[model samples]
Target: MSDKFPDQARVVIIGGGAIGCATAYHLAKHGCKDVIIVERNKLTSGSTWHAAGAYAQFRTDPNAGRMMAYGGELYAQLEAETGQATGWNQTGGMRVACTPERRREYERAITIARSFGVEMALISPQEAGEIVPIMTTD
Candidate 1:
């Protein structure tokens, strides 16, 4: 076990997931040498490792969509800087609509994503099947 960080450290962060590590890296890059990260498990061993790495910005809230977009960009930059694969996939995803209410929700989400400059398109059942060969149009 490593010694606890000094009492005078500028910042002390808990957890060692992608978010924590990224925060530490940015702080270090900005000349914050007194930053320390404490983790209960190996780095990226928690939620970060289990993340699906999907970059979809579809959400009903505009702010959330924008945040997701920013997160995707940060993840890309992190992978580039560390030369490690973060399993990011840029392939767009589709939310299947099984009912009228679900379709309305998907439409709202699509509009919010578009407001955040996220590229998305609405497709008919046939088009969706074309994109995902395993999916049935029914």
Candidate 2:
């Protein structure tokens, strides 16, 4: 980045966190110029810095799930498009449900996720434990 800020900008974003940076990136990706991002601190130094950097492609609402699915796809291709590493990994995620009610809820989410082409599944506690050996199934 240059030290000199432009006198005028077509769009000025308020933060330098993930959302703000993503908005600017997408805008520029779509051929929009003259964009500026103003940050109170260093980039990702606020809430975004504390984030777990995990994304789930399933939600109670199918629309929200679809957006998450979009994010997963975008992260997968961001490095290739920008020639910059986003540190995104495609490791599969798991949600453990020790109770029957939570299990039902996840089943519902799986249905919603799958409805919009997001692949999610419910596995036995044993299966989940197998993936993470230190986790207890019982």
Candidate 3:
């Protein structure tokens, strides 16, 4: 919880996103103390903090998928170790697109999610509303 930066570090991570924080955690856990995270913007300013605060184990690469999966698996231990709330949950996610190109992107996303063993489907905007009441197809 120290906001003051150190003079130097052996490893410098560019972002304070989940992945960067996790890397710092493991590195510190393994007895590496000279690690620093440099976030150009404020902490949690990236997709990891925004984007509905969703956690996904699905990724285009198998290794990436496994790493995401590992993050969930490690969450309990992380919270226990740091005595902090991870804010982790299983609420799932939703994406809405008004343009044809955006819809096509979602279509492609579905395929990628499926390939990564994620259970997702293309649902109507009303159906999406069932998941996130504030969401709209319009």
Give the Cα lDDT of each candidate. Answer: 0.80, 0.87, 0.74
Badly placed stretches (over 4 Å) of model 2 are none
Best by TM-score: 2
All candidates in order of lDDT, best leading? 2, 1, 3
Error of 1 at 64 (Å): 1.3
Ranking of predictions according to TM-score: 2, 1, 3
Error of 2 at 94 (Å): 1.3
Candidate 1 lDDT tens digits, 10-83: 79889898789878988998999788888997888899778755446677787888988887777668778889
lDDT of 3: 0.74
Q: Score every model by TM-score.
A: 0.80, 0.90, 0.58
Q: Tens digits of per-residue lDDT for model 3 on 92-111?
A: 65656788897787677667
lDDT minimum window of 10 residues, candidate 1: 1-10
Better of 1 and 3 by lDDT: 1
lDDT of 3 at 18: 77
